[model samples]
Target: MINKLSIVKLNPIIIREDRKNYIVEDRKNGEFYEMPNPAVDAINLINKGKPLGDIEQILKVKYPNEDIDIIDFANQLLDLELISEVNGELILKEVDQFGPTGFLWIPESVSRFFFNKYSYIFYISLLLFNIYILLTNHHLLPNYKDYFIFSWMSLNILLWLGIGGALLILHEFGHIIAMRANGLPTRLSIGHRLFFIALETDMAAAWKLPSGKRNVLYLGGLCFDMVAFACALSIQYFYPTGPALLLAIMKILVIDIFIRFIFQCGVYMKTDLYFVIENISGSYNLMENAHHYIKSKFKKEARKAGEAVYEEEKRTIKSYSVIYFIGVLLTILVFVFYSIPQIITTMSHSIDRLSSPLFSKPFFDGAIVLVQTLTGLSLLLYSWYKKYRLKKE
Candidate 1:
């Protein structure tokens, strides 16, 4: 039995279902939103206060050919704040703003054609290329020192590094593929942390899709990285003598992949993980708005010198204290503990290399080290600037 009061508490989307298409009307604005068949049905069922299980059963009965996971579908709806649960009763919630609708511009035809046609082949080619490199360079494994020395002076090092960077772009594309597969539009762009890295795909649209789709998008990048790692591992297994050289390359690849996953996928900083947390918290823009609200408090205090403003500030402060504390703690852990140690160790190693006699070709080695250091420093400065801007905003 449905709770009528809870159902009444929700603002429902008025959906007109036709054989060909489904149209959703925004009750407040009197604007109609058009969507394909399945999404229309899902939205209607949710609005009717149908339990997720019952809705899935209905969808399965009507569209027997379509494979839909009810739980995942339900979670997606929940994440978008289109539905809510009140005392175990499912209810619909009307969203005032739909966030950015840029995802709507991506055509389904383009998504289907590009992803379905190219993803598998792209992944396979990448794996094979890495394997080929390992095999060809097997003899050069024992002379890793020589290769490193040559790499310092060789223009080919830039070419090989470019190839490595391109592979990372493909890795981001894998994420876009999975997101598109789930009927979500994604924005792909180049993002720099401290160094100009490969590319990044914004799967923020995935949050509006079903939970299963979000999982695919989140895990897809890691899956591609794992595939590349597996191929590298296979090369190492077949050619054991060049283990050290292979291992070093593998370490760089794995670390880069893992760091991106942690920072971009981890939820604490409003990346993919943040979306997941929003889903779990039943607060769509909790972190985003919470940060804004906290900033507003400070602004209010600065602008209005009144006890009322101070009291309001205290209330907003109290509302987000726990979350803010956790964020600060995590920042300390990552920066002071993890990143600081890595930066110190890298600096120490670079200084030691600069002074070491191993750099017989002083000019070449010094230049290589200098270039690497400068690039690293530039990236660090850029990241700090970006963070500062984000905080200011």
Candidate 2:
């Protein structure tokens, strides 16, 4: 319904400049779009109350060589729900905000208290203390036996699951608080990264801030993990003669923290550390570009990654491609050498235990493991459905 003389009324929007594109976000529902220079110019003119025809003429003059289609651009804006009205008639589409809402009450001061320079110094010092503690007392280092803290395998599995679930909440809380401190709201939800189920913070709004300012949001979870690790080590060091169960719990936490830290290094999974690297390197599409680079190596005519960007991005993409390939290869190797064998051995043991008399210790143990396995698979499937299938529909 847009014509040359149509005066477009745009919905309220917050526009911020990214490195090469402008981010146009609807203020009400938080929907955003990344637009290049020309499109952004049209938007700016629209904001200034220019008629669609005048905006088209201005853009045509700005880019004389390119085909400037004002009607097409206006239609695209309409599709995005950016256009509230044309010729003063309401054409706005109401949209619900994406993700879980209601963290607006969290004050920025709380974030500053937790994430300031002095707090980071304390965290770094604590991490160093932990390293010293481990080095001096080699027995403090993580051991596989730590996983079997309880007498019953089922109890031990449940213990880890309970503790891990709690810690995961803490980890995600770090992200939420950091985002809130920056005056941005975020929500946590289940997501799948490859074969793993992960809790993710929807911080897409963080892009409104400068890349340098956003690193803290990415590092927030890992920071909490580091602090948790240090606290566990400190408890073990100071309370040598503490209650037996408390000491055992600390030992379990120590190993869990170690595993969590190592797991975050899995850049292929887009873990916290991956975002840190991405922010530092300014490789906004590192994973996608790396994928393209890897694909190009196998097929000659494959679309090259980072061809249009600066040389620095190209280098980051090339370097990450190598890391991505090795990471994936190592994952496959681990699955073949460790995970598969472990799953098979656990299943075999569970089957033997299940053959025992009803209500016996062995039967209960096997039943617990089976339940845990099924629960894990169910969660994985649910995560996949939520992330991909549900989104598509």
Candidate 3:
């Protein structure tokens, strides 16, 4: 016997009869709900106006899994008078793309592939080999002309730079591995950052994880670089002059390692150090909010007017912000101070070369410099524009 009244109360679409089970449909979401067979039989008996105790006995004999107190199920059925009860229900829904309103989501696939596995071994080996080459021949490594003759020149620079680029890719892989180890998702991509180079790993999900986990992921790449640097230093000190080329290579290797450390400190680019600072300050959305603030200033309008910004969303107005700002500023200041002097000196020499009759063909050199400068400037401007646009939205 089924309770037509209870079925009707649960939902208008639920129909009861002397059939196998009761079928309930959710009209709002266009979804279907199937009640447990025992429950359905009980409803069927009730619809036939049978005693509740008799229906319960029949249900008990047929479905052992439904042995729990009938009162619980009855209460749930009563509550569902406003709607239908569903278990493992299916409904078509739109995917959420905005990513939890304020937070970012790092895709799980990348984290699984890059971080949770030993895929980074390839990159580590490559870096180790390069370090070996540099330690073995420091002098010949930096002077690009030593290995290049006309035909070889075309391919050699690409090959060498390709190796360097590969190490950078591996560096990002280190971050990914760290993130995955700490139960965070991450994705790696190669792009340009101003006049410099860039390899980015999206560890946005790390914000949801604990601070220690976040720090491990953030510092993993630098840790790898530091280890390589230490090995190179050890070789230099122990072996002294292994070979002329090896020594030269080591010098160049050390220079590159040092430069990478410098680049890692580039907070304006939202590098590892930037994220670490954000994590330390308990402001997961600091960078995003700062960027938003900067964009709003440019637009002369309040982008998120009347909306209360979380402490995590506040920019470097407080102590943490000021500290990170100053650290990044000082890093940039030192880089500029060292680089500008060298660049000026290089330009003066290039100009002198342009004036000399013997080296009058300055077109190639000028083109190279122009291309490098333009490429760098374009990347910087584009990155800034992207940040501004993202914050504005």
Candidate 4:
């Protein structure tokens, strides 16, 4: 038990809010802890160096009948790193954000003016216009030939890099704008998510927001991507004689962005939809619990088990588990029926390029091809391995 007579204190915790909840952010550790209103009141009092006994007495007098265990409450905060002792000791554990490298933090006041509700209205209008254009001019959509008709080198790669880079920036900006609209100061960072490098946002502030607004933060990126594709398609339609490279670029954007949008539905991938489902169900550990349900039902690891799966999240997780299973099955089918063939075709093409003696700059081209082949194979192996591991579990 914490000493009732001893001093308790709040760390450098920043209290913030959104539509649904209050979150106490311990910035020193990049962590946020959700708190009830009473807990928030107690913490703020503790921040001023209130003693444990005095804080409990104050809460008892204020609420009269509520059972307020200030010691246990403070202990929980201590566990979450939301509060610390004032004895001048240093923290020892390692807690890192996804990517803290060369982080770019735009002050909210600087960008808040640009991200009001009107901005979303403009995005929606542009989206509607794009839809109209697509209906009236279906001929403008890109074809497979558009991708390969170019030199696919030098300027081609440069333009693709530039455009794709800009799109990704806009994508991250969408998240930043969403946070700003919700009155949160957001820091955008570049990070490595597993094997792939990505630009990510610090939406820890998002924990305080309502699920509706939380989803806005998630959907914001795809909005930018779609708007970009719509613009690219419009440009391609107006200039049939426009650089074939633009067509190639349009094709690339369409394929990449659409595939990415679809990929987000992979609850197993911990995509945006995964969080959306979690928020909708009010279960933060939905996927983890879903797997637990799977284990119990399938008797995979439960053969040695006797305890029941906790029901706190069972109803929500069971429904989610079914969807999760469907997503996994679809992903497996996609890999087996589609991805393997594409990988083989690309590998064959690369092999032929490497063997073609008359090809200029064969070494440089072969290196790129080898990297592509290796990446594809690595992804295939990882996917199967992950599936195998889950089955074993």
* Candidate number of the best lDDT: 2
The candidate that achieves the highest TM-score relative to the unseen native structure: 2
The TM-score values for the models, in the order shown, are 0.46, 0.86, 0.49, 0.68
Lowest lDDT 10-residue stretch of candidate 1:
140-149
CA RMSD of all predictions: 14.6, 3.1, 15.5, 6.3
Per-residue accuracy of model 2 over 322-366 as CA lDDT, tens digit each:
777666676665556544664565677788989999999999999
List, residue by residue over 1-393, the lDDT tens digit for candidate 1: 332222212235666543235545544333334456777777667667766667777888899998867666555545545454544665655556443234555566665654553665765576676556556755422221222323343232453355467667767766765666667656765445434444567765554444433555665665577576655455555666665756556544543443454455334455555555444443444665565555665787543543433443444344444655565565555555445665565445455556757636644555575686577567667666766887896
* C-alpha local distance difference test of each model: 0.54, 0.79, 0.54, 0.64
Candidate 3 local lDDT, 1-393, one digit each (tens): 223223322333444221223345433333334464666666566555454556666777788765644545656555444223332133233433311121125454655554443645644665676567656866523332332322322233344355456568667767765665555545664455545557677665554444555676787787567556656666766788688656545554565565666666666667788778766665545666666655664564554541345334444434444554665776676467544554564455445544545533554454444455566578777766766777896
- Lowest lDDT 10-residue stretch of candidate 3: 95-104
* Candidate 4 per-residue lDDT over residues 70-101, each given as its tens digit: 87887776677655563344435455553232
Return the clash pairs for model 4, or none: 20-210
Looking at model 2, which ten-residue stretch has the lowest summed lDDT? 303-312
For candidate 4, what's the RMSD? Answer: 6.3
Provide the global lDDT of candidate 2 against the true structure. 0.79
Model 1: colliding residue pairs: 194-379, 267-273, 267-274
TM-score of 2: 0.86
C-alpha lDDT of candidate 4 relative to the true structure: 0.64
Residue 54 accuracy (lDDT) in model 4? 90
Kindly provide the TM-score of model 4 when superposed on the true structure, using C-alpha atoms.
0.68
